[model samples]
Target: MQTIVIAGGGVAGLELATRLGRDLGRRNKARIVLVDSAPTHFWKPLLHSVAAGTIDPSHYHVDLARQAIDNHFEFLCGEVVDIDRAGRTLKIRARLPHALGHESVLRYDRLVLSFGSVTNFFGVPGAETHCLSLDGVEQAEAFRRRFLRLCAATSGGAPRVNIVIVGAGPTGVELAADLRHTVDTLVRYRLNSLESPCQVRITIIERGPRLLPTLAPALSEAAARKLRELGIEIRTNTAVSAVTAEHVTTADGEVFPAAIAVWAAGVQGPAINTRLGIALNRNKQVLVDEQLRAVDDPFIHAMGDCSAMQVSDSTAMVPPSAQAARQQAIFLHRLLAGIERAAIPVFRYRDQGTLVSLGEYGAVGMLRQVIGDRYLNVQGAMAKAAYRVGYERYVMANLGPVRMFAQMLVRWARSRWLMPVKWH
Candidate 1:
């Protein structure tokens, strides 16, 4: 049996592994192996909520090892440091903490790269050292701990806590709004005895002309209005030059005091991509063809945020979004499962629209029509319900309907007694 090795057990990687494992591994046709640095898998989109202290991450994370056992695949906990295309092997480095690391080589008949992108600091002085990012679980947990501490200290009669988010994308916008709701929840449920509510201010600085620039103008306006209504400040067309412990300085000499600074501005491919010796785009992402195979080597494939491919008939490349990643994974799975034999169809991305959550303030976004390119703008209660259903669908797909409902019931029960935020 031939071996298939997938690197980075993220959204695309995990899904593809599960599907291929069930189809090929169980049938004894192929050996499926998944490689990732993290022991468990958490949905990347929810990292912002983790940072905001709104939802418990434990409810949704999937154990990669257990999933591998159930799905007839093997899980390896390590980072893919480099790939030897000529040798058909991968160099993986152990990711054990506080210990000497070791490297190992794994051979494979075919390879798939799904390692996600990392936060791009753009060489801004002090930006990397001072600003926090929600790129992974560890970073989100660190931010949440620090945020709770800051709020606690402020409740003890210190100055107000000011959080500055240096981006207007979905992560920054959702995080700002969620932080506002979290502060209110903390005061109402946990710190009600204090004389005053926790004084927390949120400011979003966008270098673009408006927030959510990727979305339609109407949707962007709706999101901006909702954020402002929730008491979040919005500053557009502002370029940050430096970030210090005390403040964020823009190019125009304006400084904003910040107790916590978050950099959600942008993302780029991981540095490891350079070691692959493959053709990379400006963002360091592997350049692939429409079939999601590397232009350099057909045996090596790439997907998710780490790869870039142009649309079938359009000039735009596939955007690095959850939907795009999921689509690519499904596409690859079907192709590998022998669903397409003679002429393999090229991958075409269909925009299902964009949705931004604002915690208790509700949600806003645009939904693409099934028939045509028309998009219907959504807001308030309907949009909020849709936003929630979207996550529930993802959970169901990941954990199966039965397990998903069981977890939901357990979470609901915990909510009856547990506090809204993680205070510790």
Candidate 2:
């Protein structure tokens, strides 16, 4: 039996691993091994909520070992250090608690790379060291703790608490809103003895001309308007020159005193990707062909935020998004299962649209029209409902529907009856 080793237990890698495990491993055709530095998997999209204290990660993360046992695959908790292309082998270093585990090398018949992205500080001085980021579960939890601490410190003396979020992309925007909601909830629950609920000031700074610049202008305007209505500040076309523990200085010499500074600027492929010796794009993402195979090597394939593929004959590449990653996983499943062998269909990303949740403030979405290139903008109750179930629906469709629903029910019950905020 052939062995398939997938590095990175991210959204794409995990989904593809499970699918291939069921189809090939169960039949004794292939041995599927999923390797990741982290022992558990948490959806990247929900990191913002986690940082804002609006959601708890314990209820959402999937244990890789448990999943591997249930799905008929092997899970290895380690970091891929080196790959010998000619030898078809990889060296992995186990990531233990504070102590480093010995490295182990494993041979594979084929390889798939999907080690997702990391926070790109863009070489900003002091940004990398001082600013908090929502890069992973640990980082998000750290931010949540800092947030609660800041609230506790400022609740009595300070008239206001200022939080500066650099970048107006989806993460920054959604995080600002979620943080605002969390603060209000804290105040309402008497967790913070603030003079007023609006004492916490949140500001998002974006180098781009507007928030959600990749989306339609109308949607951007709607998001901006909604954020302003919620007392959140939006500074567009502003570039940050430096970040410090006390303040964030912009290119224009303006300084914002911040109790908490978050760098939600952008993302790039993990730096270890260079070890693969494959052609990579400017963002350090592996450049792959239409079949999702590395352009320089056929035996290695990449997907998710770690891989970049050109769209058709255009200069544009597929966007790094959860939707795109999920689509590519599904396409790979079909391609690998021999369902499209006669004429291996090229992987094409269907733009289902983008949804931004604002917690209780409301939500905004841009739904792509199935017929044309235009998108329909939606907001209010309909958009909020869609945003709420968007992730649930995706998980249900991909994972077992009944199991996902039961987990969601438990989460809802816990939030409603016990506690909604994740202080611990």
Candidate 3:
């Protein structure tokens, strides 16, 4: 049987593993193995909620080992250290200590790299040491703990809790909004006081001229307005020069004293990807052909944030978004299922629109191709509902009906009991 090994259990890797397990593994046509550093899986987009303490991570996370057994695949818990393209083997470091010391070489007929990206600090001094990043589960939990400690220490006083969020992209904006909701909930529970209006201040600093610069101008303006309504201050066309323990300095000679700072400004390809000696773009993303195969190695394929795929002649490369990753996974799955490489279809990215949620009250975005040449410009509750539905559909499509329904029930149960009525 053809042995297929997938590295990373993020969105694309997990979806591909499930598909292959059900189709190939069950039929004994191939052996599918999924390797990841983490023992469980959580949607990356929900990291904001996890950070803000709005959602419990336990309810959302799925054990990789359990999932593999149910889905008919083998799950290996390890961190991939190196790749030998010539031998089609992966050098993985087992998680155990001295008892399970050293590495294990896993050979594969086909290898899929979906290792994902890491937070890009851009070599700014003190930035990595002081700034909190919401890239993974641990980082999010750290932010949550820090926030709670700050709130507890300032109890019975109107404290000026300053939160500085770097980067005005979707993730940064969403986290800022969620934090506002979290603070509001805290005040409602009498954990903090909002009697002094705007006491809990949030500043979103973006290097670009406008927020959500990746989207259309109108959408950016709408998002900015929604954020302002939620009491989030936006600082555009501003660059953070450095970060200290208590303040973030800007290029314009301004220092913002922050009780907590979060860095969501940029991302870079995994470090291991660079060691593979493959062609990479400026962002360090692996350069892949139309079929998502590395130019130098057809046996190796990459998807998600690690792979840079060209979408248009003018556009240099596709943005590393969850949508793009999901689309790539589907394309790769089809290519692997077919025997004739020549007959395999090329990857085509469909512009399905973008959504930026602004707290619970609303969202702002352009629904592309929803009504022909003119996009549907949306804001407020309807827009927020639409955005949530889109995410739910994506999750359901990947996890299938049964798992999706079960997850929904689990969420409902958690909301009813486990979740705190109010969080600071």
User: What does candidate 2's lDDT look like per residue over 1-424, in tens digits?
Assistant: 8788999999999999988888887887889999999999998999999999888888888888988887888998999999999999999998867647879999998799989999889999999989998879999998888888777877556768889999998899999999988888888777766656678999999998999987789889999998998889999999999999889999999999988899988889998898788899888999998889999998898999999998886777888889899899888878776667656579988878998888878888888887998888888898899887778866675467888989989987897887667755
Ranking by lDDT: 1, 2, 3
Candidate 1 lDDT over residue span 290-396, tens digit each: 88999999988899999999987788889888889989988888887777564856787888888888887888888888898998889999989888777777767
- For each candidate in the order shown, give its overall lDDT on alpha carbons: 0.88, 0.87, 0.84
Tens digits of per-residue lDDT, candidate 3, 1-424, equal 9998999999889888887888788888899999998888888988888898888787778788987987788999889998888898999888755425468999999999998888899988889999999878999998998887776556346568789999999989999888888877777766654443366789999999999987789889878887898889999999999999999999999999999999999998978888998888877878898889888888889999888888856575777888888888887777886732666468888767788877665788877775675677778887888887877776676577788888888777877775352254
| TM-score of candidate 1 relative to the true fold | 0.95
lDDT of 3 at 251: 92
* Global fold similarity of model 3 (TM-score): 0.93
lDDT of 1: 0.88
When sorted by TM-score, best at the front, the candidate numbers are 2, 1, 3
| Cα TM-score per model | 0.95, 0.96, 0.93
The reply for model 1, stretches above 4 Å from the true place, is 96-100, 155-157, 190-198
Kindly state the number of residue pairs that clash in model 3: 0
